[model samples]
Target: MFKIDKRYAKANNQKTIRFTDDLYMQLETIAKYEKISFNELVLQCCRYALENMEPLEKE
Candidate 1:
């Protein structure tokens, strides 16, 4: 399930990442389908991944 955050559009921490064209296209397609900005999609993904990694890191 995906939820939209209205504040995600605001500029907070500005950063740049380089991605392969294929990966960028895939992420863009998913972001479009989810009706969220690409930046929001990446932020959500990074947060999700980091949260899930915490317990594993403890081990």
Candidate 2:
């Protein structure tokens, strides 16, 4: 099962990023349901993607 680590959820740094209005709404909804901050959810998504993605191949 997927779980958000409370320790990891604590922000240590900050960066600016932009999201489309639709995407922002979706993320906000999920974060509200999960009772976590929007920042935490986004961090989890980014970490998950980086950890599970395969490397790209060169032509």
- On residues 1-59, what C-alpha lDDT tens digit does candidate 2 reach at each position? 45675445778898999999999999999989888889988998888888878987899
Model 2 RMSD vs true structure: 2.2
Q: What TM-score does model 2 achieve against the real structure?
A: 0.79
List TM-scores for all candidates, in order: 0.72, 0.79
Candidate 2: clashing pairs of residues: none
lDDT comparing candidate 2 with the true structure: 0.85
* Candidate 1 global TM-score: 0.72
Across 1-59, the per-residue lDDT of candidate 1 in tens digits comes to 44555466765888888999999999999889888889988887776677666565445
Query: Per-residue error at 1 for model 2, in Å?
Result: 7.3
The CA lDDT at 55 in model 2 is: 85
Cα-lDDT of candidate 1: 0.79
Cα deviation in Å at residue 6, candidate 2?
3.4
Task: State the C-alpha lDDT per candidate.
Answer: 0.79, 0.85
